[model samples]
Target: MSFNPKDALDAVRDIATNAVEKASDIVENAADIIRGDIKGGTSAIVANSIDIATHAVDRTKEVFTGEDDDED
Candidate 1:
């Protein structure tokens, strides 16, 4: 059997193209996962910040009012 250089080069190109396509898909999936994690972390931080602010405001009102009422 005789080997043709042109055919061999074409086969090599096809293999390289497939590998690059698969690698691109993997990178895209990883990026999507990272984005989701970041969004979740940011949401949690915002929620916690709001809770802290609310608590601070309640405490400040209590300190300024000087009333011994069980409301708040």
Candidate 2:
């Protein structure tokens, strides 16, 4: 298959967006951690962990497909 530069750029864009999301999550979580919103040995920790993973996945899909949760 011929290499398509547009597809390559789109893939890179998705990856970049994912990185940005992760960075934002880190900052937000750090604050939550300090504020005790993300305490250890609690469901808050588990829920936050799941949220981090789900957001990364959802962000990737949105970047690649141009559709968001609102459209679903």
lDDT of 2: 0.63
C-alpha local distance difference test of each model: 0.54, 0.63
Task: Please provide the root mean square deviation of candidate 2 (C-alpha atoms, Å).
Answer: 5.4
Model 1, 1-72: lDDT tens per residue? Answer: 355566556545654565565556555555655778666555555554565555545444444554324554
Residue 8's lDDT within candidate 2 is 55
TM-scores for all candidates: the values are 0.41, 0.45
For every candidate in turn, the CA RMSD to the true structure comes to 30.1, 5.4
Model 2 clash tally?
0
CA RMSD (A), model 1: 30.1
What are the per-residue Cα lDDT tens digits for candidate 2 across 21-52? 66676667677778776654245445556765
